[model samples]
Target: MPILTGDQELEQRNRLPTLMEVLGRRTLAPVDLFSFYIYMRDQQRSVDYLDFWLDVSQHMSLCRHYVRELRRSMLVETPDMEKATSKRSSALLENFGESLGEAESHPSSNEKRSSEQRLSAFLRHQHKDSSGTNQSPAHSMTSQHSNMNFSRPSHEPKPSPHSEGPTRPSFMGSDQPQTDSNSPGHTVARQDIKASAEKILYTFILPGSEREIVLPQSMLNRIIHSIEEEGRDDPEVFDDAKDYVFQAMERDAFPGFLQAKALGNLVPLSVLIRLIIGLASLMAGFWGGFFMILRSIPRHTRCWLILPFTIGCYFLVSYQYKIDVVAAYLGFSEYTFMSWARIREPFVRKLLLTRAMMASLMFVAAAVALSVLFIFVPGADF
Candidate 1:
């Protein structure tokens, strides 16, 4: 792959709006979407498909890296890399380790973070670097690898797709050939790759495994055979399964993710609609009820005005759903705005959810009270 200059990469990553735009740009990754699903899943843990899809993506990344390193090692003549590889493999396979797709590119967990802020910082730095005439390809790649999706410490070097040949697995960018394929490092990277693939199989692919992803029996057997019998760890081996999960997620989960992350901005519109409708009904009910009682119209005819009032109450109360809390606590102008999905902390999300729940309880209580007033004493016109 050709090295991307800073401008080319900036153009590549500037806000993908559509599914095709995201897929075509190779900028909006599955992790971005899956991470959103995981965020929303904290409210309801039923979103297993997104989590499963993420594992599939991670495994494919590992396999792709494995195959690349394997081919690179094939041309080299090196001494046994067994001892070095053993430690690396153990580390790589440790407890379904972090996703390898762009670990170097993500921010550390402890920071007060927002995905939008990170993306903005990433774009700003790129613009500044691209403005300079003397930028090198290695420097551009390091900037991308270290801080494209998220910011990193400035002192760290750049990283790139092909640059992390297992042994050099970080953004400490270097221009040297990935390995003296003839050097003893040959087997270490490939060995790590193999170990990771096996770990993924045991953790997420095999039947009755700890966290197995749902797949057809034949597909599972084929994958098991590929990893075990044939020892073929490459993107090609998992194409069917990857396509399977990709299609499932695209058809079902993507719609919901898109709705929550994109269309959620319409929440304020819903609130406005409810507020307008509620005010109209509330006015009509109060004016009509008073007008009837003053004119001494039959209680039967005027009591029906309570119906619209009750509906108004229900909508107005339900619409409150703690918008003030969202704005005050989360500093969002709207509850479900895309930036809201950027909140990485679970406790913060739970706090917002709790406040919203309290408002829902108020709506329910108001609904029940109105229902009782109408049912038990419809003729009691006050």
Candidate 2:
């Protein structure tokens, strides 16, 4: 029924949220968050930004994974933020008594106990406990329920129903209730706890704007600073800021970011072409120098004599990433700073030409040296 994809839309359009909306989801699956952007932006042509998305997903995954680990290590009564949350929860509860005055008639003891039980169950669900066994909260609750059987005989130590009035609700010194494992309320509370955990992780891992795509460095710095400012009120703000910064800078992290495929490693096809041109120049120097030296013209012709040498030298000097094989062989002391000539931004191709010249000189020199050494060596049979 949609106008966008039309007939094609029905097959692909499953009523998914927009990219920005997915990115802002309260509970985001790491893969879903990243794929949405790639699908929206037409990834094939936007190869450069692929690294950016990879970084975002990796950080999100890591932050989510680490937070789950942190939560798994904590008990409801002993959370990582024990000192802070304890004080805050205590302070807030002091004012809760008045709010409960009206609800007291509805069996407040049972209600308070229920809330505590839910909290305990939430924690148990997150962590398997110290027993090194896989005991579920429902299993434990079932066991406790079985132990509370009120069907004992009259002679058994059961107090008379008339003697025992309703139990007084004591929020301060009582256990919380445990809802029926199959009840919707229990499922909803469990989901709420999970949502809260994720939010805490999100705040801890990405305190900033947490953009779906990392922007330019200049923009990122501004966002980071802003997030840091906002994090002042939230103790977990640092973690969030750290997560974003880590992801933004992660491309340069090498092995850790091996999958990111950043451009820094991929010299542009144009740059590669330039490098090839430079390599070819090395040949020009070698051949030019050899041909000039081969012509038996008088040495007094400085201009003619120096032409090949100069040509070869130019190629030698033009080589990039320190490509001066001639200099290395001759042990010649021409200023090595010339080697950096290839590395300058908007690279100079002169080095390529120079490298060829150097190659020529070496060929000519080796040829002449071999001819003389063979003719002059003191042996005998010549």
Candidate 3:
């Protein structure tokens, strides 16, 4: 391969259309094109990138121009597409008519043909003067062949007119009294139209990544129009657009954090800080409780030394087990404490609680034993 010169490199860099040109030409969906511009912008960290966006800001109003061009193009192409579809449908109907004509040699086939003709007339009546009506090709064909039934020849035995009771009305023919909106054929046709209209066709580049998002045209249009209207009063509409793009980009992060928290993979710094503060507060409260208990006894008594020593041992045991007195004092339930502790197993949690409670009891027993020993020992002075 040959090496590229400076001019050639510059040409390669400018090969892609500018944001203004892309917006004006209607080559890509407005949102996708803009998002791609943002992705490219985030990658290049230089004054040149700033200048590129500044150039884009000058043509922010070009979005309206592109919308107008799209409308015009649709107006031009819709007639051709409709004409083609109509021709195809008419051809299919002609083929069906020829097939029915071939079967006319049979007497039963003539009755079937007459019934089909009546059904076709009814469909034509329903569709007449309604240019915007869109029905599936299958539904249209089925409607054209509705209410068909074969009859026996006159030579065969027939049921007496008195034996036949009044018949229920048929929904498949024009002679039917009322239209059934909930009929299976109508429902299927409506569903087909809805599914086709909602099908996604456009893919947009997401900000801060090379990934693209696919969505229906209507949804994309609504999102783009909403962003445009929101930024209408702002002097820098491009900045507003950037804000919307980045907001969409960050939408997944929140759900991802929640999933991580559920899986016990996430530990927020704020939570850790809160826990540290709570632990310190609990230590201070324990010291205060010890002081209050000691004040109830004489300060000069030999039991005074035992209180401090026992309290120290209790603090050491509680700290080792990571138990906070404030949690129990605040009337926290087991589930609440489990969440704070981030422990999942009930057995391990119960074991830790047991150890903590035993430590407190041991401290109390030590204080009582020391006092009894002092009282019994001869000349055990304060």
Candidate 4:
């Protein structure tokens, strides 16, 4: 075995090895190579440093064996490193033509400790080179695993039985032998991907406030289904609902209860209350108009009064005040009323006022006419 001279070690410093070279020189299977890459990558070490280690190991042949043994030992002894079994460790040592006993007996405690310190320093140097700041190597390692992709290369064919080595565990503990889709890790990963893809964000603008709501794809699908179901029964309702949703999206405004109804969700209590109030108002107006007409009509002219009173009552009950009241009760603010008041053109205002006054006078004339008929046709019936 060749030994690395002092000058050689210095020359190879701060360089990392390529994945191919590491696999070739280390005689590692693809899976093992992947694990090694993950471990180093998590440590935030550069490819240059990896190359340096590989070069050092090649020159000092004993260095390669020792490093491999050390990694296996770390896996076995360091509880936090990875879940390593005695069988796996033995397999690794056997593959490297070394025994655990021999490895332990040969390297003194000082030498082992020194090697670990050197590796630690190498990692720290790599971290500083990349980030320009001192950061905890262990923390960096722990943080990166969640986001790392362990996808297998498409070009690399599966190993044949003769070429296959012992099944090695992933350093991240996620690579299990089972290809079953039911595996917990795989299921979680699938769910994560689905969740990330399904995330839908909608911005909602209300009076003096803004908010964002995130709906999963499943919820959106349900909403779509609801719309489709509703459409089958009532096309007009479906069209209105679709228009409402599009308008909401365009304006970034979702009025309470109305939006829920548009989405075919349950009508909110507030909306139900408004609907009830509107129905009651219509009923009350109808009854009030009927009684007003009845009181205005004279019993003597009762036969001729029905038609005029019916027409008059219809107009009276459909008055602008009923509309204004309903609008105000349903959250149309003073600002909305002010918008209507802003029509300040003299001609237009006068025309609108004239039209309103004429309607009112017509109603009063119908009542007065009835009274006059009662006076003229006295004793026709009270």
lDDT measured at residue 7 in model 2 versus the true structure, 0 to 100: 35
Query: With candidate 2 superimposed using the best TM-score fit, by how many Å does residue 79's alpha carbon deviate from the native?
Result: 7.3
lDDT of each: 0.44, 0.32, 0.33, 0.32
Query: Model 1: runs farther than 4 Å from truth?
Result: 1-35, 39-47, 63-188, 265-382
TM-score of 2: 0.22
Candidate 3: clashing pairs of residues: none
Better of 3 and 4 by TM-score: 3
Candidate 4 regions off by >4 Å?
1-351, 380-382
Comparing 1 with 3 on lDDT, the higher-scoring candidate is: 1
**Top-scoring candidate (TM-score):** 1
Q: Compared to the true structure, candidate 4 yields what TM-score? A: 0.18
Weakest ten-residue segment in model 4 by summed lDDT: 196-205
> Who is ahead in TM-score, 2 or 3?
2
| lDDT (Cα, 0-100) at 244 in candidate 3 | 48
Candidates in order: C-alpha RMSD to true structure: 17.2, 25.0, 26.7, 29.9
Please, what are the lDDT tens digits per residue for candidate 4 over residues 1-382?
Answer: 4555534533443233233333333212211233333323322222222322222222222223233434544445556434343344434434433333343343433553344334333333333343533222121222211221333444222332322231222222222211222322322222221111121111111112122223344544443453333211111212332334434332332222112211111112333444455455435544544454556644444454435443443344224222222222232211111222122222222333444455456556755664344334434234
Per-residue lDDT, model 1, residue 173, is 22
Best by lDDT: 1
lDDT of 3 by residue, 139-242 (tens): 22232212212123232122223222221111111211221234333322322222211211111222222222433455545544533332121113234333
Best-to-worst TM-score order: 1, 2, 3, 4
Tell me the lDDT of candidate 1: 0.44
